[model samples]
Target: MTALSERFTTARQEGRTTGRTAAVRARVLAYVGLTKPRIIELLLVTTVPAMMLAARGWPSFSLLLATLVGGTLAAGAANVFNCYFDRDIDRLMQRTQKRPLVTGEVTPRAALVFGFVLTVSSIALLAATTTLLAAALAAAAIFYYAVLYTMVFKRHTRRSTEWGGVPGAAPVLIGWAAVTGSLDWPAVVVFAVVFCWQMPHFWALALRFKDDYARADVPMLPVVTTALSVGRQSVAWAWATVAVSLLLWPVATGYGIGLGYTIPAILLGGWFVVEAHRLLARIKRGGDMKPMQLFHVSISYLALLMVAIVVDAIV
Candidate 1:
C-alpha cells in the first residue's frame, strides 16, 4: 500500500512538471511579445557592451546577464502598461490599431495584470541579483515611459520625442551602473549618445506617421510642423549625435577606437544629414517626401552605431 501511494505521488509530480513547463513557456513568450523584441534587441545591443566598457575589460557574466534580464522585464512591463493605457487611441492609429489589446487578442485587464507582475518581478530580481542603484534606474525608466512619456508628454506636446528621450536613454546608464556600481563620465557619455540618437530617430518616425499621430491627436513634432522644420530638426539632431559620439573618445580612456569606428560614425551621420537635406529640398520642389526611407535608415543607423561600439570594445 505504501509503495502504491508513493508511485501515485511520483506520477502526480511528473504531470505537474510537464504542466508547469508548458505554462512557463507560454507566459515567457507573451512577456517577450510585451517587450517588443525588435526594439529590445536594439536596446540590449547598447547594454551589454556598456557594461563591458564600464568594467574596462569583461563584465561579470552573472551580473551582466541578470541586468539584461531585469532590464528586459522592466522594458516589457512599461510597454504593456502603455498598450493598456493607449488601447483606445492605439485602435484608432493605423500603425498600432492591431496590437494585442487593440485587436482584442489580450484583454486590457490581463495586460494590466501582466504588466504589474512583470514590473514587480523585475524590481525584485534586480534588487536581489544586482545593485539597488541599477534596480532603481530600471524602475525609473519604466515610470518615465509608462507615466511621464506615455501619459503626459506624448499626449500633450509637439516635442514628445524629445521628452521621451529621457527614459529611452536610461538603459545605457542602467547597464553602466550595474557594473560600475555608480554613475560616472562613461555612463554619462553613453546616455548622451542614446539621447541625441533618439531625437532624430523618433523625429524621422514622426515624419512617417505624422498623419496617424495627428489623427490620433498625439501632438508629435511632425504633426504640428512644416516639412521644412521637420527636415531641419532632423539635420540638427543628427549632427549633434555625431558631435556627441566623437567627444566620447576624449572623455573616457576606454573610449579609444581605431578609425573604423570614426569612419562609420562620420559616414552614417553624413547620410542622415543628406537625407534630411533632401527631404527639405523635396518639400521645396513639391516632390514626394520619403519619410519611410528616412525612418528605416534612422533605425539601421542607430542599431549599427551601437553594434559599432560593441565591436570596438571587442576588437
Candidate 2:
C-alpha cells in the first residue's frame, strides 16, 4: 500500500507538470501570433537590403542585427495595434477571423498593452543601437499605420491604400538612416520604389477579398470602384513602381550600383508590368483575374529586386 501510494503521487505530479507545460506553450504561441510574424518577415526583407546598399557592402554584423531587431519590433507593434482596432471587422472576414483577438486567443486589453510595450521598446532600441533619425522614423511608422491608416483613412476613404503606402515604405528610409544617420534624395527614391509598389500589391489583395471589405464596410479601392477601374489603376501604379525602380539605378550611382542592377530592374519591372497587364486583360474579358496571382508575384518581385540591389552594390 505504501509503494502504491508513492507511485500514485508521482504520477499525479507528472500529470500536473505536463499540463502546466502545455498551458505555457499555448500562451507563448498566442502572444507571438499577435505580432503577425509573416508581415514582419516581409518588412525585414526590404530593410536589410536597404541597409546593405546604404553601406555599399555588408554592414557590421552588430548594426545589421540591431536594425532588424528594432525594425521588426516596430512593425510588429504597428500590426498589433491594427489588429486590436480592427478586431471587430476581422471577425467578419474569412481571412482574419482566426486572428488572436477574434478567436479569443488574446484579449483586447492584453493586445493594447503588448502594442504599447513593443512601441516604447522598439523606439528605445533603435535610438540606442542606431541613430535618433532611425528611431524617429520607426516611431513615425507606428503612428502612421496605427492612427492615420487604421483609424482615419481606412474607414473613410477609397484612397487609403495609396496613402497607407507611405508608412509601409518608411522601412527603407529607416534602414538607410540607420546606416547614414540621415536622409537624402537617393534614400527618397528608394523609398518611392516601395511607396509605388504597395498600390498594385495591395489592390490585388483587395480585389481578392472585395466581398470581405464590402461586408466590413471598409472602403478599399475594389470595394468602392468597378473592376475595370481597379485593374487600370493597378497597371498605372505598376508602371510608376517600375519607373521608380529604374530611377534607383541612376540615383544610386554614388553607391556603386551599376548596369548589373539596371538590367535586373528592367527585366523584373517588365515582368511585373506584364503581370499587371495580364490582370487587366483578364478583367476586360469578363472573367476572373485571380488577383492572388499578381499578389504572390508582387512579393517575389520585391524580394528579388532587393537582392539585385545588394548584389549590385557588392559587385
Candidate 3:
C-alpha cells in the first residue's frame, strides 16, 4: 500500500508539471507570433548580405549566427513593444485588432515585460559576441522603432513615415557594425538604399490601408495628401535610389559589381520610376493600381539589388 501510494503521488506530480510546461510553451509561442517573424525574416535578408559584404567576403559563421540571432531578438522585441505601445490604436483597426495585446491573449504589462526582457537580452548577446558598437546600433534600432517611431512620430505628423526611416535604415548599419566593427561609406550606401526603398513601399501600403490608418488617427503621408502627390514623392525617391545604388560601385571599389550589376539596377530603376509615373496617372484619374504595382516592384528591386551586391562581393 505504501509503495502504491508513492507511485500514485509521483504520477500526479508529473501530470501537474506537464500541464504547467504546456501552458508555458503556449504562452511563449503566442509572444513569438506577436513579433511578426515573417517581416523580421525579410529584414534579415537585408541584414546578412550587408554583413557579408562589409566583411569583404564570408565572415565568421559563428559570429554571423550570433548577430542574426541577436538581430531577430532585437527586431522581435521592437515589434512586440510597438504592439504594446499601439494597443489602443490597434484595437481600433481591423488590421491590428487580433494582436495578442489587443485581443487580451497577452496583457499589456506582460508584453512590456517580455519586450524589455528580449531587448536587454538581445543587446547583451550582441555585446558578448561582437563589439559594443554592434550592441549600441541594435539598441538604437529598438529605440528608434519602439520609442521614436511608434511612440512619437506615429502619433504626431503626416511626415511620420519619413522620419521612421531611421529604423528602416538601421539593419545595414547593424550589419556593417557586426562585420567591420565600424561604419563607413559602404555601410552608408547600403543604409541609403534600404532607406530610400521604404518610402514608396510603405506609402503604398498606407494608401491601400488609408481608411484603417485614418480610423486610428495615425498620421501617415497618404492620409494627408492625394495619392498622386504620394506617387510623385515615391518616384522622386526611386530616382534617388537608383542614383545612390549606382554610386555604390565606385564606393565599394568596383567590388565585382560592374556593368553586369549596373545594367539591371538601372533597368529596375526605370521600371520603378515608370510605376511611380503610372501611380501618378492613376491618381489623376482617381484610381489606385499604379501605387500598388510600384510597391511590389520596390520589394523585388531591393532583393535583386542586394543579390547583385553579394555577387559582386563574391567575384
TM-scores, all models, native as reference: 0.87, 0.97, 0.90
In model 1, the clashing pairs are none
Candidate 1 lDDT over 1-315, as tens digits, reads: 999999999999999999999978866665556557777777787788678777766677899889999998988888888888888789779998867777666777888999999899989988889889989999998898999899999999888888889888888888988886798886787788889888777777777778898889888888887878877887788788878887666666555455656678778777776776676677677767776777777777777777666667666
The sequence of per-residue lDDT tens digits that candidate 3 reaches over residues 1-315 is 999999999999999999999989988778987798977976887887788778877789999999999999999999988998999999988888888888778989999999999999999999999878999999999998999899999999888877888787788888889887888888898889888878888998888888899999998998888777887888788788888888877787734456666777788778877777777778788844555677787788888888877777776
Q: Rate the local accuracy (lDDT) of all candidates.
A: 0.80, 0.93, 0.84
Arrange candidates, best TM-score first.
2, 3, 1
Worst 10 residues of 3 by lDDT: 253-262
Error of 2 at 267 (Å): 0.7
- Model 3 Cα displacement at 167 (Å)? 0.9
Q: Of the candidates numbered 1 and 2, which has the greater TM-score value?
A: 2
Ranking by lDDT: 2, 3, 1
TM-score of 3: 0.90
Q: 42 in model 2: Cα distance from truth in Å?
A: 0.8
Give me candidate 2's TM-score against the actual structure.
Answer: 0.97
Tell me, by lDDT, which candidate is best: 2
Give the Å error, residue 207, model 1: 1.6
Please report the candidate that would top TM-score against the real structure: 2
lDDT of 3 at 187: 86
